[model samples]
Target: MGSQKFAVLLCADDSDYVKKIYGGYFGVFVRMLEEEGETWDMFRVSNGQFPEDEKVGEYDGFVITGSCNDAHGNDLWICKLLNLLKKLNGMKKKVLGICFGHQILGRALGGKIGRASSGWDIGITNINLQPSKIFSSLKMPASLSIIECHRDEVWELPPKAEVMARSNKTGIEMFRYGDHFMGIQGHPEYTKDILFNLIDRLLHRDLIEESFAEEAKSKLEANEPDKEARKKLCIGFLKGRL
Candidate 1:
């Protein structure tokens, strides 16, 4: 095969702070996921930017990014995205979803998604991975630590989908639909600093309480996300090398 091409469908607007420091969320994701031989492009789906329907097959795989919007919302762009996801599924194209991406993908695949009953999970979380064949070659640990900052989650899996991982707070920390599509409920691309900034923003907007923010900050000070392991899983899956 020729060189692999990948796309990142960004579902969040770049904050002025993120844009100033990280060149935007797209840059952050590319830095984590891109390798020497592969090419990556970004579509700001939150801004209504999307790959043309006829151009969808040009990339080897696609990665969907986290968002502030609810996955269950019927916004025009979200509806269009669901249709695109359905198209991608029909083609068996590789797709990976993170955070909001995960919830939206679940809805697209006929699953149910809504506000998580467990409330907000806004700290480093250890998700228990099933010893499924998908991880046989990954050499992953029984539990993987990652950054979690979401209020919505997948409540039901689509037909034939399998739950790959779970955490105490969320039943579907990870899930897979066949070999081509996967969703992870945490931010593998996030550094602790990014999450910290997000927490502050959430608190400032009254989305989270000061006490909750303090607790999440303390947890961040103690544990680190296994980004390398998560990166391997993502890149390997996207490249069909797993």
Candidate 2:
């Protein structure tokens, strides 16, 4: 392919499996974008290492992927990433944070994030989008079958943030910062099989119970996409400032 028309940085702060699976998700996103005549490139930020300051502005937007690490921890890389996010937000650059990325965005934007009370580990849950310019082309009750593996949720929105979507399991499932930055707690990038494999691996490692795994699997199987809803959300994001 020719040089990318837009660049997207995928910040990965977890295991190889996260990178592998999320890469697949990015492929889905890229495919959707390409179908609409867009070109993009994806770069990784692993183990805290990332491009220097001089190269930060070369990209059109950046996406921070979910991680196994807790956002409240004192990891050096996490701190650095948070700082970088602040800088990017200050510049009004487009940034989309997913899962752990969502937690970090909340923390960076002066919001509080912590473990959920229900302790819900939603695997493939449906999201209800609120009426906004972001979902104008999408239908009401837009059910997005997304992978939700996060324990922490955004408890409070920052001064300049707006809550976009929510679910019964998680109160603040989606939020937008100022106008350009957005964070989603669920995984819209994961395919059904990929999501199942992830839950399976987690079960194998004893990270979750077998019962939970089975429930998640069933949810994955039952997930139905509102394609028009997703298309509208993506197109709105791409057309807006990053």
Instruction: Specify the highest-TM-score model's number.
Output: 1
lDDT (10s digit) by residue, model 1, range 3-122: 889999999998777888899999988988899888899998888999998899999999999999999999999999999999999999999999999998899899999999989999
Tell me the tens digit of each residue's lDDT in model 2 across 1-242: 43324554555433456447555545655654444455566555545566678777766667677766777776888778888888988888777787877888899998998888878575667777776665654444555656788778888877778888888888888888777788888866655666677787778888888998898788767666454555456556755622
Runs in model 1 with CA error above 4 Å? none
- TM per candidate comes to 0.98, 0.84
Root-mean-square deviation per candidate = 0.9, 3.4
lDDT of model 1 at residue 204?
95
Top lDDT prediction, candidate number: 1
